[model samples]
Target: MFDKIKQKIEKAKGALEHSDERVLASIPETSGLSKKDIYRNRYNHGVNLGGCFILEKWIYESVFDKGGDNEFDAVSSQVNHSSVDEAASKLTKHYNDYISKIDWNWLKNEAGITSFRIPIGYWHVGNGQLLDELPFEPLREVYSRAKPWDILKNLINKAAEYDIGVLIDVHGLPGGANTDMHSGCKNSSPSFFNKSKHIDKMVNVVLPFICRDACVNCENVIGLQVVNEAVFDNSAHGQKSYYSRAVAALNRIDPGLPVVISDGWWPDQWADWLGQTNLAAKVVVDSHVYRCFSAEDKGKDANQIINHLSESISWPRDRIDFVVGEFSCVLDEETWRKTAGNRDEWVRKFGKVQTSNFANVASWGWFFWTLQFQYGDGGEWGLVPMVKKGAIPRRPQGSPTVDENRVKEIINEHIAYWKDKGGDAMEHWRFEDGLRGAIADINAFAQFDNSRIGRWKALAMQRRAQYISRKGDSKYMWEWDQGFQRAIDEFGRY
Candidate 1:
């Protein structure tokens, strides 16, 4: 395992150092006026930095035992401390190592991905689902109130060096957005939707970093996703009405910035829901389509498995606007067996088909599930290995020139509109500085009691209260404060 990880990191280093000389003989055509231009000028071709910040979707038993599902799990299990100071030291080292592993140069130069959707858990912020709850306080007191966002913030700035834009995705909400362990806790009945505090915490988690959230801003961040996969069942809690509240809150924070909402297995319903809210064009829908998990695709042969997306690949383009949030080339076991002869050919063809179909039809664009996972396993699903194999084309076609003068006119008009409303206009995403300044600005916002956020906070509170009534188990994870103190006090070395 150690050898494999070492090899992977070495390969990434090599790619970063030599990809331009080896594969990209010239500046790729996709390179141009990008950064914030990516979200509007052309469809975004991107990749997700999954399991990086929020969750650890890994095969390593050690990581699981260490409880990397959420920040609370990680701090409680991985740190053997006799004091708060010691625990903070361990967490700082652990988190820094995790975020440092990201190879931003490779993502931009090697894979040629245009944008990045980074999944961040709410705990990584100062306040999560509920600021006053257990499992949440550790995040605040331990990490300098979420100063660790420096890594992600740096990545965003580094991406601009390659002209790549980033989409800040809050993959995990407080109390678990979905039943998946990726949401921080695995439970059949997701508590995220069952409680109102979860929604409030989500607002807390998203408000900063938003270009319009405060006077501070992140320049390369083109989009902000409220939730990853908050499950949608037949119950009222699963309905799109809940998303509307989230949408309303985010819009109130940054009306110009795109607030991406997931399709959540209901394409037409979500499209209709957003349309009704008059935010259809203003916001983008995220639909994660996968064939590997479905019983319908499991029994199919290689051809059928690869061609499954052909039927509905163009659905969003034809009907509404949306982005394929996640997708991979992995096939069912039956499909794998049928491809015994010439495995490489079939794999390449499948990847090309999915890749082409998505760019052609995914209205907003497509993000491969991940750039890489499990240290260096850049397997069939990993964009790094796939790009190396040439299964995925890294050369993005040159898009049409954007009307820069028209854009300026629109911005000037928008600023005047806001100025008329008695609110000082913000720099917004296109003009703001990158992550470092954004983080410092946010920190100062807290310290100085920034008054601009009053309106946004009031709107968020209204939405949280408007949604799910607070009637159930108010004391879930009630012992966090005591446990946090005990964890700090009980430390005397491992």
Candidate 2:
């Protein structure tokens, strides 16, 4: 089945290479878009639905009252204390009630969240079959009966009704991506990168299943996160090799679907690597930025931290699309102790700077670390409370409308500047066409959802390909590129 899918992808690539209009048309238009089209075009102002599927004891302590620090121990403790069916029932209840319909309504209507990053485990897929020969195999009966994949599908379909996108984050790999408890186990030592079979299951079996199910069955799924927080030496542990295979397999399943990869706490390294490698047309880097973890961050006062953020948090703009996949408003208590200002005031300042920096640098906007917590309003970590406190903006600043008069003025300025220098040699009309093309795209997205286009680099590349295919190559193509960039900058001004 995998081989056949690869062959089909190759054939499709050949056909697309042979024809330009076919490729252009393949890029979905705004008016009558499929789910994949919606996923591709919109900027994501998202929040993680943490502790729903992938259990985190800190997020909700009551769920772990039975004595377990991680999902593995949680289930193991429950099964030992009670019957397998009862343990399954308790977990199923947690899943069902974690995010209710009312929460969804609030996210879409009031909070203006455009997407959700849903974390799940490898054991969550195939119900029980995926757990075979893995550490989670002992608890297969509980998950198989609970049927998280089915519930996840329902959530995806529900998100679609609200016109929200979902990114299925494989938070927990077969062994464990990192030593963290959130990796679906309580192991002191991580073994996911060390085991070839573990990578195989994820790249071949698990990821392909997710891509097929999402693209075919649940279109609201924006992308499949290959792995979450992979802590390893990139070159030594088959991490890069795993990424190559995962990208290939997913592209074969659905070339339109995007694949997200973690930066392994090394954004600059991966950014350079991605710039050089021909991995995929739509690969994104997910960088989880948190200021509270490091000792340096802990020592800084609120103002100092904010200044550090302004200075330090930046990404190479032209390389690849990267998102602050996870970030929070919380600062360490040590920093809070050093500050003299009111806690609420400092919290607001902290939140504003982080969001501002992320907006300036992140290609697809950002997702707050979490949406909710079990206890007292979740303080800085919760999206709902943070929004209520005016930390994160209610919605992205509204999309800018194209001012035709201003556009005309710019066009006139361009033509007048180049007329004497180029005479007939300069093709100024291409610039006008490119500018108008950008305006049309902006308007199309605005009509669709009052949003600006996200992933602008990838979309620009596609538009360029379409242009070259239609008009053939020319020395004057730079004019079009300049015009497009000008329009983008103009829109940003608004």
Question: Which structure among the candidates has the greatest TM-score?
Answer: 2
What lDDT score belongs to each candidate, Candidate 1 first? Answer: 0.54, 0.77
Off by over 4 Å in 2: 1-35, 232-237, 396-399, 409-431, 475-478, 492-494
108-175 in candidate 1: lDDT tens per residue?
Answer: 66666667888876666532323456345555565553354655677677776766778888776666
> What is the model-wide C-alpha lDDT for candidate 2?
0.77
RMSD of 1: 19.4
Error of 2 at 113 (Å): 0.7
lDDT of 2 at 35: 39
Report the lDDT tens digits of candidate 2 across residue range 36-126.
6656656788999888899998886655878888898888898998889988888888888786723778888888888999999988886
Please give the TM-score that candidate 2 achieves against the real structure.
0.88
Per-model TM-score, in order, reads 0.67, 0.88
